[model samples]
Target: MLKRLLLLLCLTGHVFAKEPPDVECLVVHLKYVHCSWNKQGTPEVNYTFYGWFVIIRDSADVSECPSYLSENNINTGCNQPCGSRFNSFYTRLVHENQSSKEKEHELKTKVKLNPPTNLTVHYGSDSNLWLSWTQISSNCVESEVRYRINNRNWAVVSIGKQNYCLNLPSHSSLYELQVRSRIGYACGLSEFWSDWTEPVVWGSNNSTDPNKMNSSMSVWTPVLSVVGAFILIVLVMMLLHNERWVICDSQTSHTCCSFLKDWFKFPEGLKEGLNYNERPCPVREYCHVRQSDSESSDCSTCSVTTDQTDCSVFIPVNESDLPTPCSSSISQF
Candidate 1:
């Protein structure tokens, strides 16, 4: 009898020694369960995966999983019509001896969900939130909510306590909202949880409220516009002020140019006060001719002023229209 018991122990040890298939399982939004084994690296017919099936046990369901590995060897599973979220489900694979080798996997540990999408926040009259978002993964799962006020530390709210996170405290102060998810108590392992979603803010408080910004920016907008216009004007003036001055060529200066200049020059009036006439060069064209003996002239020069009685004129000639030549013919005085 002792030998028989020893033989049973040996058989049990051998069964345990045989390596299990590498089984991984996930659900498609509760549409179906998919379990794959030893996807590609193994040398078995199905990439070292022998015909096998997944086994799952959790708080919600406890049984050898009905899901089958696909013939393609990559994927297989049973229909899970409930489309449920799973939490803390233990999973492993079973295959024929000498077919494949693998270890156990938790649904939560195996499947990593993307962050929730399209998070939005709206405050209701009762201070409740009209918050909503679509889960990133098609598979159904449970989620938790977190919130903060004015850049403070984050605070958590139980998803079970609040339906779809609707029981937030109503406040006028700004509030930041965020969410993270994990496999639920459904058919999957719930050991893993996704990273937090991007945050959303909502509020009507004027002071320190992100949504209610100060009006100082609006006031400064016109001032900035004026300054910009002034700068533009100054730039345009500077560009136009750079004038190219061409020297008036000296070669072109002539009588005509001088005449134009003189014509345009302001006239200073002629010399005033006591006027005395004097010819600049009085002796224009003449040589002194001696008076003829019979003429009895006092001087050789022809006289112009007739009223110099003391030195009476021998012959008067208009100085304005003077004679061309003195006549040499003799005449009696």
Candidate 2:
């Protein structure tokens, strides 16, 4: 009887001395099972995880984890192919000569999905800001969006669709947005929500109204163009005037006056009762020729001159030479 009593005490002591590590299991993306454990009171000792998934209402043979996740060359987690959703997970931790007690976990509510990716923001013509992202499982997940204006407090809203729109957004304020997702009820219930995605930003903090700036630009563009054309025309006119001044400075004063008068004077030849000569009245002509090949031993010859003609003569005119007009009455006195 004393031996039996000692055996009973030994068994009770062994059971009380053993402490199992805390284990956790999760279904990732509804495709695989991941189980991990932490050393509860055995920090110095490393633990290796092993798990088996069995249907809740069915019996199945045991299978080992396909891949083991390790830390510091010690097995710390187990990865197994996911079975039915209505299943229970059995996990154990082992360390060489010692092993932990088996633990059970229900996996129906333990699903966790990856975070949404490629978050995008767009401002539409209807004064609305649209936010959207690419989801891993498009129809099987729901999302929640949180946004803040100009680094202020965040506003969160739940959405079933992949996109959300904010109507009549403020143009002067900046908008910062993020989204997170979880499994929907139609697919399966998940107790965990995905981590929030990287933030997307739109709009600005400037206080100036964009519409007013655009209107001002439209108004000033045409005015600036007209002003530029007028300046160009004035510059061309000034250049032409300077060129005329240069031409006048290179000639005699009489020629310069004639040059200026020609621009404004009408043709005298087109007048009615003028008896002026068609050709110049007192033109002088002089002609001379010399032998180009004359030598020093040969006698030099004088050039022949033409005699002066009547057309070449100059006559002075006085007031007495002018013709007198007929009198209305032949000296009535």
Candidate 3:
């Protein structure tokens, strides 16, 4: 009886002598997992005796008992009990795997952008529209942005540095512009589009009636040309009229008279009186003779004798050579 009791006490002592399983510390590194054993036993005994472990599973939630076991051998004293050992290790493994999966999911997810602000549109001289806006954030860069005009095709633009400008087509049609920014690789995340910029309508001033300007220009051109031609004709006529009456007053009147006399032939009598060679004839009815004071005339056919000369014969003389004549007349036979 004493031997049996002693054997039972030794068996109980041996069973309880195994140290309790510890909670494992699983460390996550950049690309790998590092796990350490933390047990209630002495450091020297625990360090080399327990092996680090890991388990990969698909499911997010599962009971701790059925999941998996450590590939490394851990000496849990000589008894090697099963249930008490696995709880801490299993909990930590499940937690570490969940954490790693969550981190990977987050990395794969894309970023997003806020809506654009202070949007404006302007018309350029080339009949094109220019669209501009302020940056949504400071992290915008590269060809990560794209746009659409009026829900048409998407046009990519470089957003590596922020800010964007869009050139619109040449037309007066109203357009609805939509802009989106890429948040992650391959446009993983995008932003809500901005409202249309007042529906910019483009076209020429006379787009509705294109022919009106051409007609107006044509009419005015002919009218102006006719007016100019008329003015030129009038100026030429005036110049010609003035040239016809141009006379030099500084010339003598005698020269004018002489020119007129040469231009037109006069009657024979008028020509004879103006000629220098014609002698005065006494028989002519309209003839006059002049005598000098120092001279005397002697006539036999008529009873006329005086200091003045009788009109028996006449000679042509200049008016300067004539003396003062006495008042008398002779009767015709």
Candidate 4:
């Protein structure tokens, strides 16, 4: 029974030692082929790789891996140039007294390209946006552009060229753009896509937006115009009313009419009249009469005078003392 257990253990060890590494090969940007493998359960064992192209009649022309990717001096991967011909590639991993099964690959479809470069954006005089970039791969590829407005959801567009135009773009919106590329159907088929480029930003709220300014002004312009017109109308009416009361007289120092003076009368606490008492003195008439203290007769001598000089006089007399025949003399004065 002990001998049987020893034999079984030896067989198990042999099987474990014969396990092969997992290998994979792919092409990059149509320039070279990269082959990599994962080490199987043997941490102490070292691996070496061999690869070659298959020709007509299944003839084998093998060669060692030109450049090796290693870890701890153990080969894990290799890189080689891909010539201008399409063929089946054969690869295998080998370690002393143990070799992995040969693996075959058709690399026409396993392609991946690098991201695009130098993305730029510009605003034209016609209020349009232009986005462009530089392509690093020489192969014919179709580009996809992804963009967002004002940090919103992303929108994608596919084009055959490297440049795109947006007509009549909004002045108040922000734009962000990125690009990715893949092999075109016209050149060949590829299952992989390149990585997206770095994001390019244009426009922002910090900068002045002409469209936003104009929109705000449009709401208040009409209200300001109406207020200005109302003020102008009030001023014109006041000027017309004041023009009717204005008068010029050569005889007096004041130029206002009598009706205007009444309109400008002061209140009870201020001065009373409009300077009527300050007028120049006019022509005067004088009347003279004499009477004795004795109670003898009711008649008296009366005299009247009209002056062209600066003498003036006034006298009061009772009507009963005036003789009826002398009334004509009093009437003349």
Q: Residue pairs in steric clash, candidate 3? A: 141-159, 141-160, 142-159, 142-160, 172-202
**Best candidate, lDDT:** 2
Give the alpha carbon lDDT tens digit for every residue of 1-333 in model 3.
999999999989857654334433321211222233334543333222222222344423323232122324432222111221122223322221332111111211222234444555667776566655554444532223454443457566555544444455646333444343334334333332323233333344443354875787888999998888667656644663587533322234345434534644434554443333322223322223345423453322223433322446555667776633433344332
TM-score of each: 0.32, 0.55, 0.23, 0.55
**TM-score (C-alpha) between model 3 and the true structure:** 0.23
Clashing pairs in 4: none
Q: Taking the tens digit of each residue's C-alpha lDDT, what string does model 4 give over 66-160?
A: 89877777677889887532578888878884777898888777777778787899998878899988875434788999998876799999998
Give candidate 1 regions above 4 Å deviation.
Answer: 1-112, 135-141, 161-172, 186-189, 204-333
Which has the higher lDDT value, candidate number 2 or candidate number 4?
A: 2
The local distance difference test score of each candidate is: 0.51, 0.69, 0.40, 0.69
All candidates in order of lDDT, best leading: 2, 4, 1, 3
Sort by TM-score, best first. 4, 2, 1, 3
Cα-lDDT of candidate 3: 0.40
Tens-digit lDDT track of model 2 for 40-67: 4323456666677666445656665668
